[model samples]
Target: MPSADLLLTDTHIRTLDPAQPEVTALAVAGGRIVAVGDTDDLVRDWQGPGTERIDLAGAHVLPGLVDSHSHPVWGLEMATGVDLSGVVDLDGLRGALRTADRLGGWVVGWGLDHNAFEGRPIHRELIEDVLGGAPAFLRLYDGHSALVSGAALDAARITGPRSFDQRAEVVCDGEGRPTGYLVEHAAMDLVYEVAPRASDQDRRAGLVELLSTMAATGLTGAHVMDGSGLDLLAAVEEGADLPLRLTVSPWCMPGVDRAGLDELVALQKLGGRRWRVGGVKFFMDGTVEGGTAWLEHADCHGQGTDAFWPDPAAYSEAVRHLHAAGVRTATHAIGDAAVRHALDTIEALGESGRGAHRIEHIESVPDDTIPRFAALGVAASMQPPHTAYTKGDHSDEWSKRLGDARAARAWRTRDLRDAGAVLALGSDWPIAHYDARKVLAMARVPEGAAGPAQGLTGLEALEGVTSHAAIAAGQAAEGGRIAVGLRADLTVLGLDPVTAPADEVAEAPVVLTVTDGRITHRGA
Candidate 1:
């Protein structure tokens, strides 16, 4: 084993730098890499009395996984929440609800799948029966919609199920009664508010849970979305012993205007001290499964998809606002329309350097819009796992809505890369489990376990999770690779990434994670 300033040898390491892609030895001193080269040669020549020497026996070591996007802290809460991923019908729901707690306020549970229900919607009456006194809110795995008890509507002050507008999609029955289902942004927000909000303590504890689970999954860094960015920073500073480095990319909903942008700017200025505020996050459209995702083409299922834009014109201004104020922008655009709208917002920059505007999800980026992204200098912040996402049997009906060709482009890492778009990978945590290797495997698996033509090489996929992700964040100097003078943040995997098989990636243990020379996590 090498000392704090040790020389680890006999290692096939992917430096992940274009100039020099491979190195046998990686030298760490004072946390930042001091040197990297032939272990035998360096040892024979530069080895010092204090330099600890360790043997790798030719294992493949690469830079630690820098999860480009995820809400690690937020994921912790969801993980602790009820596991409703497989409940399809009321029979399954009741069986699981035997343990459902009567939390006094809103008895909230998440990760329910509508694919299991008839018409793909959970009836509101069923929820009300189980949730007698208080309101109850349950979220779908994608976080796009919620199933609420009738009590939830009263808590929110909705007089009748009919009172709610079309956007909310309260799911009225044939008799115009509340059906217990909510869809799109309206349902997402309305039902979310009904759920118990995480208090400061709850948030802090979530971080603790988040960091532990993240480290266990071979992740060393993450970009947290949706949750309060400022609160995360405060929690990080409050002595939260999270091994994972944090990048807070909090949500900036439309209700937030110029005044709010100013506050965000102030927060951004203060960010990057310890943990960083990676970019400005905003919702441009809704989720597809929830029927909120904007559509240029009609739903193939004959049912219309939601293309509701929240103040479209203001988006360009908002893009410029974040850029002019000097905060990077990452917008959540699940639909093709949202993706196009966001790109158009960036294109409006028109000779103004707004930095890299990120287009989240890109589930259905049209071919024309694909090439324009690079020309427009926008990074496609996409989910690589969705490469395998559509393969699930439950997605067949949703696939019917997407048609065929467009649906196949779910995780277009290679296309985005070939189009000259910078590709940054994320799990869209909670939407899909936040597993870095799964992202890598999906990127290479092409068909993501479905289409052989779409699979990428391991290296191409690894880059999406590493250096490329670093470049997207405009932190080329501080991140994505193991190099001299760069901050000493590295992950020591038990196996070498260069040769580690896909089956082994997800389970590959991280032996040690060194952040600034301190071993934050160690697993044998």
Candidate 2:
């Protein structure tokens, strides 16, 4: 047998494999686990002159963590310029804009929370005075909308109101003048068209830095929700390997025709050693705070009754078309109506669609929607850290918008798991902090944001990012466990995550990280 390329010994390994639940040592060859046994025996048998062995000194090692949902490549654009996530009110917002950095002559910023507006209608006039007449574009934390200055509106040639293929709106006043509050992607893109963008060189560097940071936090892989930077990713992979694995999913928007669908199908064949374009992303509705969530009933403001798609039937037809071609899909459905519609669409695919589809951000849903996930074999890809956006007392924009009844059901991670759903957890990144540890911690003890919602057990929380994450990406056989013959990806920590306190788990020292037989991060 060939000598192992790498060997990890003196570690407590939790394989998550029933056959080999625990082991003292493991060997890697050709980026795959070669063997697992007693530390001394495996060392004597597999270690050769070329083998690199590490003694973890009693550290706990588990399958490398995978963030089931992230947008590292595209988040470069979304998280650009200054960060306004900490600002509390309109005054704080003005203060942030006044001190914000400019990108290509524009006062660009992101993470502007809807709560910062203080129930006031958004308009350019609020921050225009602070921007010094520079064209400014500020992204709301939800990523579904933006608030641009009048200078930006002029730059994009947006006058008054316009029509969109999606349910986006220019958000005008009594006089039909755009209020600078652009709701949804289509409307926001008007200013984005002329907004300053990072150069490909800057973007490539930023992505490398971002992924490396994620690796340091113990992330070995991510399910990238956007495919915009495929060319950039391909270039990076060719020049050098990515620090983590990425599964890219391009979007299938509302206006796609048959030719567009064929284009997406052909794209599934594109891949490199560590990255691949595999799935499609669709938006069933916008966000609850933005008044775009497709609720079963109207929100308090009477504005959450519509879907993002102008015609919901087109979305189903697109899914059917993709399903027949054997391509899996992940749809962004944040409201009860949107979740139900997406599930209904997948249900229409019969048994074949089961397990082949995922619904992202199942933020709020009724009791009936919980069981359908397991019964239909659909995966619930949720972000536990997103709960931080709401308040436990139901005073936040999201809770107030949904009223008490629906808002109380926020992020039912535990309920869905109890009902036998394939639950996959992630940090939406730019939307929330991308720390995998925080994700584990939040899933187990939701702190104060979840409003008395039951948290997952420590073991179940770990599975969300490990085993269940792989199932969400349809890579259960190729990865997820620490068994022999599986991919050589592992995360070594100072303590056992499953048994550690939630607070400790969030701040646990990451001792080491391995991806594809290569050490990506080593902590002091």
- Which candidate ranks first by lDDT, i.e. highest? 2
Task: Give the runs in model 2 whose Cα sits over 4 Å from its true position.
Answer: 447-449
Report lDDT per candidate: 0.68, 0.92
Please give, for residues 1-524, the per-residue lDDT of candidate 2 as tens digits: 67899988988998888898899999999999989978999999999999999998869999999999999987989999999899889999999899887889999989988989888877888898899999999999999989999999999998899998999999999999889999998899989989989888998899999999999999999999988899999989878889999999999998999999999999999999889998999999999999999999999999989998889999999999999998999999999999999999999999899789999999899999999999999999999888888889888888899999988888999999999999999998889989999999999877434644659998888899999999999999988898888999899999999999989999999988889989999999
Residue 242 in model 1: shift from native, Å? 3.4
Q: How many residue pairs clash in each candidate?
A: 8, 0
- TM-scores of the models, in the given order? 0.88, 0.99
List runs of model 1 lying over 4 Å from the truth.
1-6, 41-54, 78-80, 88-90, 104-106, 118-120, 126-134, 161-177, 184-186, 197-199, 227-229, 301-308, 351-355, 387-389, 392-395, 446-450
Residue pairs whose backbone atoms clash in candidate 2: none
